[model samples]
Target: MATTKKYTAILLLLVILGCQKQDTVDNFPIMGNLPMGEYQVGFQTLFTYDLTKNAIPYSDWDGNLYQSPTSENGRQYQINIWYPAQPDSGTRLKYADYINLMGRQTNFGESEEQKTFARQTFITQTRNLKNIRDTENKEELNTEQLNQLLDLDIFARLDAQPAEGQYPVVIYPNGSSPAYQSITCEFLASHGYVTVAFAPKGRFSSGMEISTTGLEVAVDDLEFVLGKVSEKSNADMNQVSILANAISSSVGAAAVSRNEKFKAFISLEGGFISAFEQRLLNGSSFYKPENIQTPILFIYSPHPSIDPKYTSHLKYADRYYAHFPKISEFAMLNYGMFDEFIPDIIGAHSGNTKKGFETANELILRFLNQTIKGESGELFDDSFMSSRNQIDTTFVLPSLPKPPNMAVLKDTFWKEGFDAIETIYQQLKSEGNPQPFSMNFYTEYRDWLAWKKDEDYVYRSRLYDLAYDSYPKSARINYYAGYFSMKREMNEKAKRFYRQALSLCESDEDLSASEKSTLRTYASEDLNSLLK
Candidate 1:
């Protein structure tokens, strides 16, 4: 009887220990659903300096002046990359791992005290407890729950071997916070994209400024990061996209407008913020909505006050605006509700929020697959989005009254001839549009007319007339007019144009040495031929 009792007690103890272990595993703090991909995710943090630009003295998150042991010679960047990796290649990273990286920021080799201070500051800011209490779940959680949140598995491994084959690249510019969108970066990596993000500092400080100069700085940093990521063997630079959040969306829009290398743009609860739209997007010359030819996906919270005029500006790109009803902007980028505090620091906890998060991930993946990867998916179809009650998406094709540029004018000329150019120019001028043709456009059109003069003399002469009338100060335009007039056997008119060309070539300081010499020679020859 003693032996039987001893064995039963031992068995009961074993069962209790097993249950405790299981409970610990279950209590690891859920981060919503696991990454739904075949390849494991790999993460890496790279610290490099852009030698072309100078660094500026900046402050930390706690508003303290950042003093590094070594003086920075150039602009510092802390680039975070997450990519598809070989399964089981490296150890999985904890949420704390990312927080630690966030602490390093521009100072990768700081003292222990500084590192700890930065790390704690990052935790405090990322937690955003006040916002959570006010906007999210108000329930006060126990200390254990908050501690468990840091130990959550974030689904990305550190320094894992990259998977075989090239992957599309998605660049996320987080402004000053390198690890702001950690979950989103890892999610894209798991879905077969090499995601890259960097901490973009301001021109005079470490923190990002809200001015136009600040926006330009962000765009420049993005371009530098693009060059660095292109060096990766597994990165398909040809199929790259920009995935931006909040104010960074304006930066992305500006960057996409300048660089044709980007294949698509994804904005997460961004792009239509009133201040950003007016100051960053509309105010900056770099943010040309008409130049954006790639498709755009805008996932935003439904705000009735949002102006539809912003969407109409994107006349050249296919736009899809997805409105998540009753969902906060923070919830779209994060996962799981109240149970997960670290990932959803400022996020709401509700069934609807969870559904919105999942649907957003699906929508993003499908949109990328269709737009960037050239896969024929149902992202644009109504039925595909109809299945999700949490999301209401509307597809807007390129609209009418396309913004006028050199390319538009050229296309109009090609289809309907020079008469269409005159009509459009007059119409645009009558509408109070100043400077119908840019100086570059005038130069390009003049050169184009010169190249195609022999193909159709009648059409060429008409184009030359338009060019000379628009830019009479251009010596090259006058030379071309004289040549075309000579071709039409109008010797007297040709002589008059040639004389004018020679006078401008001699006096026009704007004309280059080579241009003036060529124009003078051609004009003199045409005038002599007219005399003969």
Candidate 2:
């Protein structure tokens, strides 16, 4: 992303180095599982050394970093399985062990220095927050904070056998970056499900394989793993699910949309973007969504890599539902709060904080229990859409009304306002008569200009005018215009905008719960100020 040639060159070199992976097996963590669930967790690493039968030919895959082109042993993947351990199971494991296993199990092992830095960095931050400043308590606090961060009891036993005849299964896949294994694996296992994930370190490539033939390879690898899962004595094959993180959301969404194999697909910050959304920059389409009938639930937060001022995660879910109409559940997690939950960790994919982590697990548990297990009433009901009767806005995305097609703009101004900008862009791109729509819109709007929806409104009155006309019904936009107008001393105009925003918010279905709450709160304040 750097503009300088030297830095850009260096980044490119790092990309190749990043691809080098360790041939060693995965060393899964042994922490006492996360505590929200009833059963204590017991975890073990697994490997399916081969998948030759009914397998895609070795020659078919473009790259095989692990083996020869025509490997006799077929593709192998290391799996991490967490399950209910018996109350009398072995002593709880140490967090240091968890960190060490993770260090070596990665595609390439981290340098001893890199691993040490990570450990010390985490410990120091934890020590400060917990106020464990006493020098002597270093050892004690290290252990305590580690467990606190992960919600595990290193000394506890796993409830190996569930009261039910067999434990249901959950297959979790990492995102494109394949950075960290989600703590959800342990949380689910602790609650009586046989939760499985590809190892935090070793078996990451399959999950990373979505470029061209990567998706097919991932599916093949998954099929092989699931087939082998039937061999796990404690696992129940009848009820199974898949949870995907970020970019992997595409894979899960695609799979669920195409078939009936998975009972539920839980997306953490990613969805079927490939199906309807196109990245205008490179003119690339990632993956197409399937129109299958499987139930799917989404939990979305802004991508850590994106600047929040520019992007609102509120629309990602809307885009997906707009394309595939059948999706039953969607949540737009508030941005700033999620960042607070995982201050030390970055990215929407981590999902590793006290509040952020728990909310995700609880919803997932309720959804799985209700939909797959045939239980009911555990989840919040119709009120999920009520802006007033919502849970702590910190944890829930506020919902607002959305009619199929309506806007705040008067019909007379709608067509003319947007066409003005379109004509400007047209001239700018015209070979014979190119002209600037002003230097700001020309240079600042690169790939972003391709999508009219992401354009700025507050500063660019034309954009705001165009947007209000284009999506006059959007509570978020109306609220922005009101706030912008109020700040700029357009008292009468601001008053109208504020009043309109308040009204539109009640009927604007596109605004997520958080968006609606934000608009309503600000508009009320401005409207109050105007009257005074």
Q: Which structure among the candidates has the greatest lDDT?
A: 1
Model 1: colliding residue pairs: none
**Stretches of candidate 1 above 4 Å error?**
1-31, 58-64, 68-70, 110-115, 127-146, 176-178, 273-276, 303-305, 335-351, 380-383, 399-532
Candidate lDDT values, in order: 0.70, 0.48
Using alpha carbons, what is the TM-score of model 1? 0.69
Error of 2 at 250 (Å): 1.3
Tens-digit lDDT track of model 1 for 374-461 = 8985575877766788765565555333337677777887788778877876676566444345444555666676675436466567
How close to the true structure is residue 43 of candidate 2, measured as C-alpha lDDT? 71
lDDT (Cα, tens digit) per residue for candidate 2, span 25-84: 122222212235666567765644564442122111133443222223545455667777
Single out the weakest 10-residue window by summed lDDT for candidate 2: 320-329
TM-score of each: 0.69, 0.46
